[model samples]
Target: MLAFIKRLLIGRPLKSAELGEQKINKTKALAILSSDALSSVAYGPEQILIVLITVGMAAFWYSIPIAIGVLFLLTALILSYRQIIYAYPHGGGAYVVSKTNLGVNPGLVAGGSLLVDYILTVAVSVSAGTDAITSAFPTLHDFNVEIAIMFVVFLTLLNLRGVTESASILAYPVYLFVLALFILIAVGIYNILTGEVPQTLHTPIGTPVAGISLFILLRAFASGSSALTGVEAISNAIPNFKQPAPVNAARTLMMMGGLLAILFSGIVTLAYFYGIVPKAEVTVVSQIAEETFGRNFMYFFIQGTTALILILAANTGYSAFPLLAVNLAKDKFIPRMFLVRGDRLGYSNGIIILGLASILLIVAFHAETEHLIPLYAVGVFVPFTLSQTGMMLKWLREKPDGWVPKFVINTTGALISFIVTMMFFLTKFSQVWSILIFLPIIVLIFHRIKKHYDAVGDQLRLTTCERSPDIKGNVMILPVAGITHVVENSLKYAKSLNPDQIIAVYVAFEREDERKFEEKWEKWQPDIRLVTLHSHYRSILGPLTKFVDTVAHKAKEGDYQVTVVIPQFIPKKGWHNILHNQSSLLIRAYLLYKRDIVITTVPYHLKK
Candidate 1:
């Protein structure tokens, strides 16, 4: 029944040969991979206004200049990643690029940064999406964290089904969000050009707290950089695309960048022109929609799509995090379990871990977007700087065709990204100090894991001295309570192994019991000799363990192997197991830790 349910939800597990069928075309790839950057426009501009509103209503004008700077950075990053797509066509991303061009430690730092950033992407996107829903209903505000966690679980299960299935499931919402935003932008622009006042024009402005300054403006620009978070996901997951993987991935990245530029710039410009303020009850985008389309069907449509795409934007993380984890695991930086593929050929372990981590962040922060926003951009920009720097090094070393132009572009990108990374860190230092502490610890963990794998590899290595055949014969020991069908079956199986000798040992806690067993053994006329041992402490395993140890010591001295065969019973009902003492299980558990001791069990089926 459990298997049936799993098949029903996740579909039948595909054979390994079916992996090629899972590759997605450019259209589905765009929706699946680009949702993170595309969805950011919904809240990216508002993050800027959130900081700008601290000074006064008049300071809102600075959002335009801040957004322009963010847009310029976005373009540079897209171009740099496009070059990365071609240079490392096997989906190198930041970690692979840095590892190959830079040193190992720098590569690990890049991997750690991308890992943390992907987790935060899921957390922040889901939280912001939940905020959108709560703004509309207002009554569901209490269950925000619960709802966000549910969304994460849903995405996890969908992804476990397969990559193409998840892309198909998520594509519609992304398209809907794009359509809704375009409509909102067009109508808002039309209203402004015609000199017509909105129905909700007389909205109250927020009370100013302090005056604007250079520090505040820089901080606002840093905060708005959240729009650039998912831009590198395309290059990271280039293998998931159809034939000509890098070209398809590059085209998708270009399309995503163009959409982001238009939607982000248009939304920020319209919000400024309409004088929309960030409100506690409604969002900046929601307010813009309300002012342009009023409380009609179209207004609700825009809100609904915005909420959906933002929540589904977590899909972007679900796609990239697992692939990144596989890369890290391949390099021995993390556990090997993440390197194994699931029945559907996805990195099931990584997907589940990413979901759990995102859910933890949501619960810890109470699903508040403002609380998570400061923790967002820092992890992302670290990889941005590293990837560009790595690409610059690649060009200088290889000197391929057009390397000079590529080198110049990447050099400029590296400088800009490094400056922005520093600016982001300095502006949000109070909220982001935990990341500074967390990164070094993660790097240390990576080194420790590498050491462990290296040690295991060294121990398992084959050597000429250890390859000679054994000179002595084998001995089998059978432990029995009494001569029953179970014991008889075990003895027959032991004879099949053709050991040099077979010893039947019985631990007797009481003398009368030992006498009765000996009498029965003689009456049954079994050819095997029986050895009876007395336990003064009434402990069965203690005496048996000492005997086995003595046997193993003698065998080691003569290059022999001692096999312990025990008899067990299989009951029809699970509850019947409690009626049995489970002595065989206890014996096997104790003997397994000793080397060169073979343990085997023969089970006799019970009628009852």
Candidate 2:
């Protein structure tokens, strides 16, 4: 969907040459990896506001302290993950960490969290995009929910087409979003310092909560920490990096961390100084643009740009979610569908599923963005803390020289991450915490499913009973087009089955039908009954279906076993287009309704 949008609107999809090669170098890797992190510039602040929404107006200003706290936590977390990228860059992010230390369950928690978060990223971005569009075109204000859905469908298809292709196409728009943020921040800061604070700047909105309660503070911090959602993308995609994977991965992580920190902090500070709040209420930034750039210029362009950035932020989710799913499946968490890569080059099933899931949430909630924030952070941070903790565990296990200092750094990372995750859990997953509650429950279901499959596979020990045992009086009946080589092969196979009787049957389409009279039945099954039914009316499937049905029925009544063998050709012929086609598929479906009676296919490969 992303690539299609780029091609449709931006002239063409970005080719390999656009980035100067077929290989994913450090620049491409970082761009791809950092996208999730960098995209926080658009939504991180929004998440903070979302958490504060219920408490009322004054809580909006709390975004600053919240962001400050998250930034401190994120700095420590990023440094820890850098160590992760260094240790295991072949792909597996938290799965590797958890598996290496705490075991697969915790690893899967990380994997599941990453997977869900990636999906939320898409939903949040598109929902925010609806707001941007509404701000620009008031007429669209009524259709924000519908528009977000349409855009999500578009994005899902782009991902189905291919992630690398989609990512390459999105790189520029994402860059544009960051560049737009930079411009906004630079201009806003300049205006603030010049004592020319925009006229649109308003005093902070009123807080619904009366006091500085601990719950409100925690909620505020949780909202601001939304910026941290995409930091794990690099670890998930370590394999996509070029040679010296670990080195490249670490470099990419560092670059992403620094750039995102700068952008996220800058955006938060600008929003604070300008007194911009979420559009659900004042939509402060858009209003600020009206003052600074003039209503004529900022009204349309800024609105358009903000929408583009929000949409692109979701692209960051598209990139991260599938990677997490694949890693989870690789480590035996999710089903194999997550492991299935489509023809165009992505986890098409996973992409569509995520997109559809996001749409359901958006519509179900009526695009109530703030109401969904609790469900938002719980899964993301479980993996975040686990991965960080895993890194600390790994570093501690290694215990190299200068181990004390490295251990100290890792322990600090682990402690901070654990605290953040614990706080999110207590704040988000209350018995009344509807959305957050389901996230873990679903994760548990997947874990049970994985365990079930592994156990079944382990118990499937083969024995001789798997093959036909009551063999002495058994007979193998083969259906053939005629006495062709397929008939001869069937005869040879029947002889191997060592049946007391061998019968070859054919339902004649026409007396002159070459297939029914092509070869010598006498030479192949000379001693057995080679029955033929005259098809005076050319009804192939009906007669064949009835004949097989009669044979099975008679066998049941007579206490004899029956097996039908049909000769299958390698390729379809021209006439097959008009005939009762997909005979094998249809027959298989019909046969599945039966209790027993094996039906086997003998392929007659036409050597090319």
Candidate 3:
């Protein structure tokens, strides 16, 4: 029944040879991989306004410059990653690049940062998606965390089916979101050109508690930098693309960057011109959609698509995180369980881990996007800095054709990303210091895992082949309750081991039971010797344990090993197990502490 349910949900298991057939082409790849970056436009500009509105309405104009700065950084990242695609076609992303050029410790740092960032991507995206839903219905606001978790679970199950299947399932919603945004942008620009004023134009602007400062602007920029969080996913998962994976991945990266730049810039520009204020209930993007298309069919369409894309945006992390974990596991930086593939050829362990972590974050934060936004950008920029720095070093070491240009581009990106990373630390220290502290601790954990693997490798290393050591004597002892089919099965298995001697011992609580067993054994002529020991206290384990200890001690004197074989009964029904006494369990438990006595169990299944 469980296997049928699994097959029903995830489809039939594919062969290992089918993995290549699952590789996606560029069109589906863009939707699958770029959804996170593209979906950020739903809340990225809103994050900027959220930070700036803390100052006065006068400072809202700063969003344009801040967004342009973010756009500049986005461009640099796209170009830098294109170079990465060409250079490292095997798809390690920041971890591999940093390890190769910047050294092992830096590489582990990059891996840790990316790992945290991917988890947050899921949390933040799902929370924002739930927010979109609540904005439309308003009644479902109470169940935000539950809704977000459902989306996570849904995505997890879809991904477990297979990569290509997940991409196909998610591509339509992403395309819908893109179309909706473009329509919103076009209609919004037309309304502005025709001097059609929105009802929100008359809405009162928020007053600043204090004047705007450089610190406030920097904080806003850092917040808006959340837009760039998922940009590296395409580079990280280049292997999932079809043939010529690097070229397809790079093209997808450029397309994602372009879409993000246009959507983000348009939304921020419209919000600035339309004078949309940050509201407690509604998001800045929702407000812009209402002002552009009003509370009608188009408005709900935009809202619906926005919510869907945000929720499905987590697909980006689902696609990349498992692959990243598999790579880290290959390097012995994490547990080997992550390296195992599922029946459908997905990294099932990694997918489940990512889902559980995201659910925790959503529940802890109460599914509030604002609360999670502050913790978002730190993990992203750390890997960006390390990856670009590594790329710069690679160019210097390799000195390939056009190395100088690549070196300069990478250097600029490294500097910009480093500054942004430190800015995130300095500006949002109280809220984000946990990530900064977590990175080194995770790196230390990686080192510890590597140390453990190293030690195990040393212990298991084989130098030379030799013949197996011979035992001087081997004794097999079978403990029987009575003359039954279970005892016959045990004796047969014991004979297969070819022990030097076999003794079937029976503990008799009464003289009558012993005499009956002796008479039956003599009549059966079973060829094995039967020894009966009478117990005064009627304690089955006590006398049996002492006999095994004596046998073990006698065998140890002659460099011999003792094997104790016990027979276990299998009942058809689970409840039937309670009907029988579990003497075998007690005997095995008592014998477990003895060093030289080996215990084995042979099962006899009962049809009834």
- Prediction RMSDs, each to the true structure: 3.3, 7.2, 3.8
Q: What TM-score, to 2 decimals, does candidate 2 have?
A: 0.75
**Model 3 Cα lDDT, one tens digit per residue, 51-73:** 88787677787888899999998
- Model 3 misses residue 82 by how many Å? 1.0
lDDT by residue (172-244, candidate 1, tens digit) is 9999999999999998889888888553443233424357778888888888888888999998898899999
TM of each candidate vs. truth:
0.91, 0.75, 0.89
Q: What is the per-residue lDDT of model 2 for residues 241-260, given as tens digits with 9 covering 90 to 100?
A: 66777788888788888878
Model 2, 567: alpha-carbon shift in Å?
9.7
By TM-score, the better pick of 1 and 2 is 1
What alpha-carbon RMSD in Å does predicted model 3 have with respect to the real structure? 3.8
Backbone-clash count (model 3): 0
Query: Judged by TM-score relative to the true structure, which candidate is superior, 2 or 3?
Result: 3
Residue pairs clashing, model 1: none
